[model samples]
Target: MESQPESHLLKLRKDTKENVRKIYNLDKPGRLEEAIKILQHWIQKQDHILKKDWNADYLDKTLIASKGSVEKAKKQIDRLCTMKTLIPKFFEVINVKKELPTILDLAMVMPLPTQTEEYYRVILVKIDTKEIKPEFFMMYFQYCLSVAEYIKTHDYANGFILVYDCRELNLAEVITKISTVELQQFITLLIEGYGARLKGIHIVSESKAIEMLINIVKQFLSEKVGNRIHVQRSIEDLPKVVPKGILPVEYGGNEKSIKELQEEWLEAITSEEHMEHLKVMYKACTDETRRNAGKFNEEYMGMPGSFRNLSVD
Candidate 1:
């Protein structure tokens, strides 16, 4: 039979090597450094391969071993056969130029995939590494881009939709009195401008937008910690996490500022009329139910209603 494919031969040869085997010897004596070095090499190889072949990826692959019999596994695989998601095949440690035996590091992960992909690449490193740090947001956007790109190229074949995921992100506390006008400037750019490559952005999460707003409201919130905020801003507030100096071309009257957006938001959120309209009902517990609750004696709870359990008391 013809020799195994060049890739298979490469794999087999490496599998036979002592250095390659060291990658898996995490607990072996004197192998920790080797394992780290190997993993780093693997990541470098992935980077190189991605930059080399347009259709090849270097992410590790996975095996699906179900608890069911072979038939079930086969059926499961068949079901997934139609899925559009890329399946990771397995991982390998490719050799890198002599770095260091003491270079073994762990915890940082290197991945390999079955096929090469066009993932979303954000240019936020420049901004993040500078100021108004978004914290792990670039990575989130990276993943979002990957999923969005995969769906776009695989499913739509060529179309656009307003794709944004704004589930949540931690709101960083900022100086209470400082004007976030600079940051708002950045938000305009983010919403209006595209990503690094100017390619169509199919997905953009709005979490950072929320984060910035939190920063803007820090001033108001400072007055009442733990109390609910009565937002006086309009619902269409501009983002507050924007970088120092950048604004989108699209603003009210084709001209606006962070202050204006904040004002609009204030109008929407703080209007006394709006507050009354926006009821925070507790499902309207019936008056009869309230009376019943009062009738429940201390025996049911096995405790006195006002025994003053505080340590001081």
Candidate 2:
């Protein structure tokens, strides 16, 4: 018999008409309600949470990312709440007014206007190392967190396809300049707490030096995620993996240019509403009383020792 098509692996369906919850297994009509009840019980049982840091949308995102697994979503939220105090270097409060302009100038994270047939949102990362400074690293990470949060709230259950454009980058310099601890922290959160599926990572216009970069990155990521990293030697070859229609004109697609995409994202992420939401997110993380109540184990509080061991300065 011929093997099933790979597209079957990405297939999703509506779990319930009332809730609009999508999942690969649609047999459970009450999955969303059951997951929400489980999360609500966990929230009430906790001693902290002076302001109720989360809402239904937050729970929905966590549940959807966990594929309707209440146990997994609970663990995810626990890690998320504990992460801010545990990793202040990356998860602490960021002053958007002071940081947003520089972040926009140095890096552009543009989510493609359309999703793929599998409903995966495409995100393009355009970095200009020439404009980046030491302080901009954390800002860049904060911007990424903002983007992830937006997707979690707005996109329902969709995963992501990340394209890293390294066309004009000084590969060696950029890699060495990044902090190992911070990089590990970011990767840990992406894998553990972000509550969104990272479908694939596509590296385009890469240099010969990318092998070293990949080796270092794979140390922090699992074999499964490592396998998902695709290196395209030339822009012309991107369509073999990423469809041409989703790419920008420079990459043989009809979407907006990098500059236009950058400006659009800058406006979206810096709007008054988004800025306030970011501030609230930071405040929720910094609540010491709330975090103290969780009482996470030393090893489980932040980056696992195994992950730390993978970090090379």
Candidate 3:
């Protein structure tokens, strides 16, 4: 995969880089570079990985996401490639313009341009229409992953804060349409496959049924992650968790409106350069035949391939 040009990449604040390094215990001289080298060597040795030539920046992000553990980074990379190979439905047809318009019309999922004081990138999900469909669950996740792919290459951050604006959402209607199996798969892919370090998840809603939705979501998350979820009775309370300066104007902040940000992100993911990049990335899957039989069974035997008989521990 071609590396995004330096000029196009998001510029990280000098202090943000230093702070993240310190937090991840990668502040020591040559420590981060050494970890990247070790990860690169490990990838080259893995016969199952079809693409061993991963970019340095990609390796760095993987290492950071692993919390400075080279071993965990190794597992993370293997799981990601394995999922890409097994879950063809998610990886196939990544053309944003052709495949995502319907879902985009129902809701907006975009990473805000600014970072919080703690340096966590906030991703805003706004559901505007009451006409929710069952198929939208997958498409919504696919869109989020598309944006994540962009972040993997261009941005630097400590973790992510998800702001889910569901004020207009019909939770009772959505619950009936959702499949528990697919819900588990989406959570797994987000945390395990993509290595998303979720600092927090803020759900903005006034509906009493919001608790029902939260209960369903928590079943798929670890106790620690479940504890990170905060329910907001109003958008006015958002500033207490996510700072005002970074939030969009609609939420009583100084940044651009969510509509504007959504449009900009839509344009970006559908851009010719990014579309070609997604096609190349969708091909970075594992070759199971080349993998060690014992290791493959030990690692992935429990996983539900193609969403058949899915079970989450």
Candidate 4:
């Protein structure tokens, strides 16, 4: 297998790495190395895990998401593999070149090139059409996971800030198409499976349907995360919460236009090198037959399909 290539779409800021090291207490002599070693050993011992050769960079990001807790990181890794195994809909077909272009045509969900002053990466999700199909939601979820996977392997950041542009959205059309059960699973995969440390969720819209949309989405979020969501009356109001300078030119910022950013990301993610990387990552799922029955039941009792009553909180 070929080694994963470095990311050309996104680059860590000059001070970002140093800042993360200090904040995560990785600056101490051998601290980060020791943590990675311990996690590596645990992975080797887990018989159910099919892909145990996770690189140091991957382990380091897992630790950062766990906030330096080794125990939490272990559980996170377990849940990640388990979720991928159980949820084939999201992990089964990751052919970016073939599957992603259609979804991109419908809506744009791309991470901005600029990181915030605090080093949190920003993701821009722009939904322009109201003619959303029921099947497209799953494709959208898959696209998100693809982006998250790309970030996991390449980018380093304190957390993620999601900027959702709903100016042209028809909430009534969108809400009916979105299944609560699927929503739960997608959020679980994003936070637990991918270790996405979400910092904020900012919705940009002027539609009266904003309230209804927020109410529905809030059900899947914890109080802490729910509180982080803010609705902007207009794009002009966005800079109040998110920096204007880092935003796309369409959003009244200095950066590239949304179209340009999206095109660049599309090309980068669909490149032959990244496609190979995704092929390897798709095999990182666990073999449930090999997993201890008791441990499996204990850890994933509340997984989406296991029970009708699901709560991400």
lDDT of all predictions, in order shown? 0.24, 0.67, 0.82, 0.82
Better of 1 and 4 by TM-score: 4
How far residue 243's Cα lies from its native spot in candidate 1, in Å, is: 34
User: In candidate 4, what are the lDDT values of residues 1-313, reduced to their tens digit?
Assistant: 1112476566567788677878878868899899999999999999999998999999998888888788888989988887777777787646665766677777897888778889888899998887888888898898888788889888888999999998888877887788888988998888877778889998888777788978887887778888988988889888887889889999889989999988888787777877888888887888877878777767788777654233322
- The TM-score values for the models, in the order shown, are 0.17, 0.82, 0.93, 0.93
Worst 10 contiguous positions by lDDT, candidate 1: 55-64
Higher-TM-score candidate among 2 and 3? Answer: 3
Shift in Å, residue 111, candidate 3: 0.9
| Inter-residue clash pairs, candidate 2 | none
TM-score of 1: 0.17
Point out where model 3 deviates above 4 Å.
1-11, 304-313
Q: List runs of model 2 lying over 4 Å from the truth.
A: 1-27, 49-53, 91-98, 130-133, 286-295, 298-313
Backbone clashes under 3 angstroms, per model: 18, 0, 0, 0
Please write out the lDDT profile of model 1 over residues 99-184, one tens digit for every residue. Answer: 21111110011111111112212121101111233333333232323322222112211112121212222223223322354333
lDDT preference between candidates 1 and 2, better one:
2
Query: Candidates 2 and 4: which is better by TM-score?
Result: 4
